[model samples]
Target: MGVRVLGPRDLSAARAVIARDPVVNVFVDSLVQTSGLDPRRGAEVWGYVEKGVLEALCHAGGNMVPVGAGEAALRAFAAYALRRGRNCFQILGPARAVEVLWEALEPHWGPAREVRDDQPFMVIDGPPVITPDPLVRAVEPVELPILYPACVAMYTEEVGVPPQTGPDGTFYRSRVAELIRTGRAFARIEDGKVVFKAEIGSVGTGVCQIQGVWVDPERRGEGLAAPGMAAVVELARQLTPVVTLYVNAFNTPARAAYERVGFRTVETFATILF
Candidate 1:
């Protein structure tokens, strides 16, 4: 098997490998197009091939590097990362794959820090039922000013870490705003108050990613999450055939909420923060 940096010439083969991997949710087609448009800010995606048939792949974006594959493929990908000056790497795959890769690399990289425990990723194949209760309404563009604060509050209360303000906030806000402005975000408001929200990202031919899901603590247990998430799923279905989202493994409440909306656990991914 040979590992190589993927370019425009290798895009077709690289996409095939990603499509074969059930756990890959980044929508390789959209990534390739976006990367091609702006080569400098694009993430580096590597493909592993044997006899010219792609078998595995990995993605490195900024400080986050997600490596997914078997032992041999992972080792080869790791070497490629090392050669490219990547010090920190995050492996997002099954628990067994993560265990194997971490064990193999520990000796050379000191100790691998378990930044976060395994996270459960939920995938929705069909339309989600809009549950009755808590009154959900689609948010308007004018409500973003209010929605942003509520989202930050919800994230802080549930995740224990407040959303970063200033440039960090700007980064996230701008990204979400861009998605919303482009009709990719949906909000669930209760009595004119933004209680929950979800957004779609990285759309491809057959897949779309659902991200930035949040619910206000005050509105918890009222059964608003299912319909709130369903709104995003409904929106995604309009653009793609499938929808997927990732959640922190330890967050049981979020998992339960998503399950109620017809999302099933498809895989586990680790989020390595440096």
Candidate 2:
């Protein structure tokens, strides 16, 4: 068995592996499609080859994502990632694969800042459960200024880091603006403040993976999440056939809200944050 950095020549084979489970592969596929398997494109794909065949892949760079990789491949990828000295903000994907990869990297990386070991990978293949909240809508460019703080708050609370650090929020603002331009940023606003928000973090094949879901602390119990999510789902389906999101298993309330919205756990996912 051999593990090596994949190149453009390996794109088709790598894509096939990603295609085997597109939802789980959405983040990697986004890089492949846009960046053409080039490491210089801010991401790279590594493959484990067995007798001249690519058996598994690791998409590592800013995001260290693995797909369809078992023990051997994961070990090699972890070694390679550690050697390259790139910042892997997160390692996420199929539960078993991610766990295996994390185990292999544990000695080198030590404890992670956070480990979400049992994130339910959920899907809404059918219509979302309507929650009768008429306030949810896509955030407009005009509202970016008003809603940017909420996005920052969600990022800080979820990732344990302020997204807009170092006297520069331009990049963060542009990212939010881009999402709004793509019509992917969904939010509920009241009196010029965002109360609930979510975004289609990645899209691939027929699915859009939802992320950055946040509800204002004061608005947590107002029956806002289900309906706000329903609105997000409604708009997302206009672009893709299926909607998916992963939540920390210990988050019973979020899990319950998703279940109420007709989502079923299609698989379990793991996330390791550095």
* Candidate number with greatest lDDT: 2
Q: Quick one: best TM-score, which candidate? A: 2
Clashes of 1: 1
Give candidate 2 regions above 4 Å deviation.
164-167
lDDT of 2 at 197: 93
Q: Count the backbone clashes (under 3 Å) in each candidate.
A: 1, 0
Model 1 residue 117 lDDT score: 52
State the lDDT at 38 in candidate 1. 34
Q: Residue 149 in model 1: shift from native, Å?
A: 3.0
lDDT of 2 by residue, 1-274 (tens): 7778888888899899989888777777777887788777757678989989898888777678888887877878878877776577788888898888888788888689889889998999877876636788888889988778998999998888888444664888888888999888989898998999999888888888899999999889988888888888888898888889999999898999888888899898888888
